[model samples]
Target: MYGIYIYNSKNRNITIGTKEEKKFSLDIYQIYTHDPLEELLNEFREGQFSTTLTSKQKHMLLKMVRKNRPAFAIDEEPLGKIRGHDIELYLDVEIPYPPMLRRPPYPESLESRKESEKHINELLEMDVIRKIRHKEIV
Candidate 1:
């Protein structure tokens, strides 16, 4: 299991949780990850790879993240509600809501659980997912 913690980047850049050799990447506004999982996620979020770019060139990448606001607004408290957004604006849209049921978590072996725990811890560091105090199905 491996993950990266990018201090400042749009999309929160989360890679798919995988069971593999352990590794991690660290970034400060600028980021470069040498993993296929992250590379693919980057394409969907920020664009392409620039691994060969010089250090000075890498700084240009900082501009790619969303400016003036954090990207994890919906991932914050009372999840899915962005500040200043009026629900009325979406009244006409047929938004897909989650079913009101609690499915048991899939069974996993110890090794798999350990791997997932590491990945979840990494997500905590990046604020891609925050702590929840209670469980409520909606």
Candidate 2:
């Protein structure tokens, strides 16, 4: 149900669904082999993928020999010469984390301290306060 679709540039064709059950679809979009390759490489360089390559993805094309990889290249032969459906290439790329989910700056500012104190005071007045501990770092 959840899978990527890859277009076969050699014959101006496209395949949808999983690798095993790849069904031929219309080739409305032009296939750009180099663009996807470059984007994947850029993502790898940015450390967006998992630390362990094998765990993240079952297959991957090495950077040095990317051209040799069938998924990254398109055959120059005529459409009639090619047989069977083209291979589907899945990039080892991950969706980036939301900006708000990242760590915030340390050392609260004066305005931040005031706002926090006001909120805490309101909570205390509402009798919703739990155990509180204050410590001063040396």
Query: How does residue 109 of candidate 1 score in lDDT?
Result: 100
- Per residue, candidate 1 scores C-alpha lDDT tens digits across 1-138 of 555433345434334344234334444476765764444345446445578976445444444433323542323432222345434323343436344334567799999999999988867765545677677522
Candidate lDDT values, in order: 0.51, 0.53
Candidate 2 colliding pairs: none
Among all windows of ten consecutive residues in candidate 1, which has the lowest summed lDDT? 72-81
Badly placed stretches (over 4 Å) of model 1 are 1-101, 136-138
How does candidate 2 fare on TM-score?
Answer: 0.20
Using Cα atoms with residue i matched to residue i, what is each candidate's TM-score against the true structure?
A: 0.30, 0.20
Best by TM-score: 1
lDDT of 2 by residue, 15-111 (tens): 4666667667564566656665556666456345556666325125445434344333223311222225445656454457566546675688999
Candidate 1 similarity to native, TM-score: 0.30
Give lDDT for model 1: 0.51
Candidate 2, superposed: residue stretches over 4 Å from native: 1-105, 133-138
